[model samples]
Target: MFGDAADAMGGMGSQEDSLVQIGVLVPLSPPGWAEAGRQLLGGLELGVREVNAAGGIELQLLVRDTAADPRKAEAAVSELAQLGVAAVVGEYHSVAARAAAARADALGLPFLCSSAVLDALTEEPTDLVARIAPAQSHSWRIYADFLLAAGHHRIAVAAQTSVYWAAGTSILRDHLAARGGTVIELNDLTPAALCDELADSRATALLLLTGTPEPAVAIVRSVRRDARLAEVLIGAPAGQPELPAWAALLGQDGAGIPFLRYLPEVFSPLGARVDAALRETMSAEPSFVAFEGYDTITALAEYLRVGSWAAVSVEGTRGQIRFTRTPGVGVWQWAWPPAQVADRDPAAPDRFRVLHTA
Candidate 1:
């Protein structure tokens, strides 16, 4: 059950859950993955409700819509700080989360990133910022391993200009290179032109390393229509296909495109309970992003008591949550939750199949 919620959109001036007033930054509008943001928000709301019901230190959420804009995220952080939020949490976009983390650090506000996976979230390591999502490098390397196992030695990434995309490309390139696989970056090409380049490259797999629906959906449509690329496998390591929007946009064409998702092969007891709770709030089964949201608050409640990210040891919906300093990661990180490569089933587009795990 959702608790007493006070959100900015609800005229409560930036809050979805109310107790101790925590600022929640998320993309609830266009140009961002609104579906993902909503799921994250839903999970956060549920977590806040349960925590208060348990008679712990009450927590309140001040929700701010980043709309996938870094500037908005920066300003929101400032506003939340002025409002005396204990800490800020939540963000679906990596770029926006990075901007929020920077601003949060500048103001000495604690920020626990929920779902963004950018490796270098901060310019320099600071105690103020911590993350729950597995870094892009960790997840992408596992994805690279999946590619190699599937016999895709030659891979091509159809990407646009973005730091997140660039970082993903680097992870794929570096991981694949070490395993004798070659990656081709197809940038600045029209969907039609991209198909030509993809077919010409002779890469057995084409990864959609671009943004949602605009060019990503268009590229998938073009590639699926091209008979020359029929045999080429399409993958989205950044998890575009995990959401319902991808299926609504591409249907059958969206299936078979493997993407990385953090989920266990078997759910823990807490995971099962949370999953059931989430299913009640959602029309479809919730994704790991939601679990990340729920866990963020659960962890923060414990962190508030311990006063250290590394000391945070709580039972999260995903598994036992513990923070550690991962190599090359600038913030306290939940070393990883279970990660797997999954795709929609071609027979039933609504169903997802776990293809590979790491």
Candidate 2:
């Protein structure tokens, strides 16, 4: 389903010149988060353009579509390695990132994973792989804080069965329980069943962690339809708010439901300038994944600017980027991007507000 390494980079201009080649792996097709692929590509291309404009090293993106498949991810990394890319970035799925990161490690290449959030993705120590997004535990902590602040002493948790969701759910449940909070119920169930549990538990809040936006949307829709859950606060941790699907699917129902996202303050001077520039070229509002892609490239370029990749650190739109050894996650180092909780406004369905930062 793929060509040789030479064929993969054949369309790219000669690499023998001053160009610094970087590998871009993203899902660009159906069943592979194609929307996120386009957004990530936009951010990466924009970052590279800005860098070149500022007289930074010339960058050439050797792009590959992971198709959101683990097998394809492995193939993409192998192809990028054979093409001799200096570094890699941008993956939307944890399954794919894990497979691709292993390949990059075996080849001794630098890989900065953008959006995948499984805690185990960076468990072991290796210099080859790093991440711009926080693990499940970190994001869940932000959620726990929000619930605790809201006076939600009794919480009902429901999640998908994937390793990523399970990791996040466990962390969130344990943290909340340890903090004098009570978990009335914690289990995985269908949307309708989850709604029933939410209504029956008499919980102050329902914490829903799912593998994708579709499931989160379903739960929200279920909550909206059930009259019994009228006063129960709904909170979704991790990247649910960053998914374009959420906004499109939830509509007015999204109001009052807080979810974690990584958007910079839109009205702030720097944020306004950057967002405006991005809006000029993008069809959708700039998402957290987009910023992650932009920051990943920018961070890598800063290291390139210093003429070394060894223990390098750089400030980015998300926060800081530096590879520190992490254990029990994977064979790579990790760094967390800054994140915040955001909520849709019922008065303005198209508008959202940042509620808390982490």
Candidate 3:
């Protein structure tokens, strides 16, 4: 009967009769953000391969590119719905995810997000939109904790003024105040002005809340070059992998700064397994974004196979993966930790690990 139902949904062959069709919408051509999107998709593909091999509800992933545009994301969601996909995943950008989630809700299809960390994603939650990564609030809280533990009482925040950064800043400020630390300075800096502001701040630590690595490197270099700010520690969200440029820019000092990452040491074993699989299958290193893709699909596929619609939760490679319905939206929670970077080697600052809450 399950097999028959699967086939009736269309495109399921005899071998695939119990398989679910999952739609993945991503920004394969996001003007300048193409590589990140490609890496995320590669992770998704590896995840699908592993799950199918392990004998679960077979999943046929239908992929579409949203080009990092909100309008394109809506169109992608429509296209996925028309293709009879049971669930939709992706649109890594927060803006794109918000646009896509609305459409997914309208169609009553499950929307799973891997990257979008804007506070708005969970603010007006619905049952149809779920996430497999920590929200921006959680990331910022963790970042604040790291700074507090490092004996830094005064800090500065520099970030883009986007929805993601705004939410992160709110969380950071709240946490910093609670720890008896004052945010002496907060600035909205362009790519160029970010350096000048950092040079002028008297804070001992700088917390950055941005998405990509390029801007982060620029900011780090600015601080490192300033004689007065040499002792100032720098940190950012850990989601940005240690790209080569970041290493070159930070050199040895980058290792001293902490980064907020979600993957906990408790989940290291699981992360290692997934990381190994990703590296083996995709010819690329597995990032937190990739882990998000893996966990979201695994949870969704399990829910489909068991036919349980009740709120389901499971441990993911990085953190907890679960679905819950809110008044206006559905929220997905992933396991994440408030962590700090312990040390940095100029050759491998990107390899910083996390120290979770005890």
Candidate 4:
């Protein structure tokens, strides 16, 4: 209902035989993070190209733009399942991913989630679903530790009231409170008013747990301009800074604000080569979500060949991609991808600096 479906990519020279259809779910339209969706799609398309070229299990991609709507995602899964897709993959938004995961699980379809990491992907554990990104608790705790080490004991979070943000706020608060730190929640305030609350809290750091543009961009601009908040550190553990559009919007103000990223300090050989390819394809630096999408296909191709998630193990652009039942995570998980706390260099907003790694 949001966007027309496209038979985006198909393997060559498979006219006599049917190529396995992989339904790709992503946010390619507004309300969703469209930039993230395109990056992810770039990776997935690249993976599909490479996989087909390898000449074994053929694949065709049926793409649905979720627009970050949970209902759209669930309906997409149902439609895909009926279309006889062997597997479903991709999604950048956590809420949409969760809905898609639940539907896939109920329908007994395998869903390889690319980037959403809300911790509780499904209300109950299921072998039918798996994830490629590290859980929110896993990475956000690392962000929390980075805050503490950077001498930010009193941290504040300006967030929306989503399960994802609430989970992040709780993780930071619990992890920080255990080490004599406190978290302040500044919700529903206008960006200017947010700066006032942030200034009054005397919190050394403000973690942006809100979505991009509207409140997030406005809040960053307000805090950067506020004289009282000159010393307050702006952070986005949810990774607003990872988006290129963010820098284009905020420019210099976007720099030095640390956020979570899921790339290793060193890229694997496959990672290195794919990075170059994606850069050429995208004509810019690809976000980690791209790598996640590439890996999702890499994993799914193996599953398509072997027809078992347990038998799916492959080297992806990031590292060795494998799935296992992880504790606290309700679905099969990659266990983790590499996690880092990074920020754009204030000197050159295009350049990113890796601060902490795990």
lDDT of 3: 0.65
Candidate 1 per-residue C-alpha lDDT over 1-358 given as tens digits, one digit per residue, 9 for 90 to 100 = 1111222112232333434778999899989888889989988999988988877357888999999999999999999988977789999999999999999888878899999999999999988789989999999999999999989999999888999999999989999999999999999899888888888898999998888877889998999999999899999998989988889989999999999998898898899999999999887679888988999999987776666787889999878889898889999899888999999999999999999987
Give the per-residue Cα lDDT of candidate 3 at 289: 61
TM-score of each: 0.94, 0.86, 0.83, 0.94
Candidate 3 Cα errors over 4 Å, as ranges: 1-16, 31-35, 184-196, 211-213, 241-245, 248-254, 266-270, 307-315, 324-330, 334-344, 347-350, 355-358
The predicted structure with the larger lDDT, 2 or 4, is 4
lDDT of each structure?
A: 0.88, 0.73, 0.65, 0.87
**Candidate order (TM-score):** 4, 1, 2, 3
lDDT of 3 at 244: 36
Residue 265, candidate 3: alpha-carbon lDDT: 51
RMSD in Å for all candidates: 5.5, 4.6, 4.1, 4.4
Weakest 10 consecutive residues of candidate 3 by summed lDDT: 1-10
lDDT of 1 at 245: 84
Stretches of candidate 4 exceeding 4 Å from the true structure: 1-18
TM-score preference between candidates 1 and 2, better one: 1
TM-score of 1: 0.94
Q: Candidate 2 clashing pairs?
A: 122-330, 123-328, 123-329, 123-330, 124-330
Off by over 4 Å in 2: 1-17, 184-188, 264-272, 307-310, 318-320, 326-336
Lowest summed lDDT across 10 adjacent residues in model 2 is found at 1-10
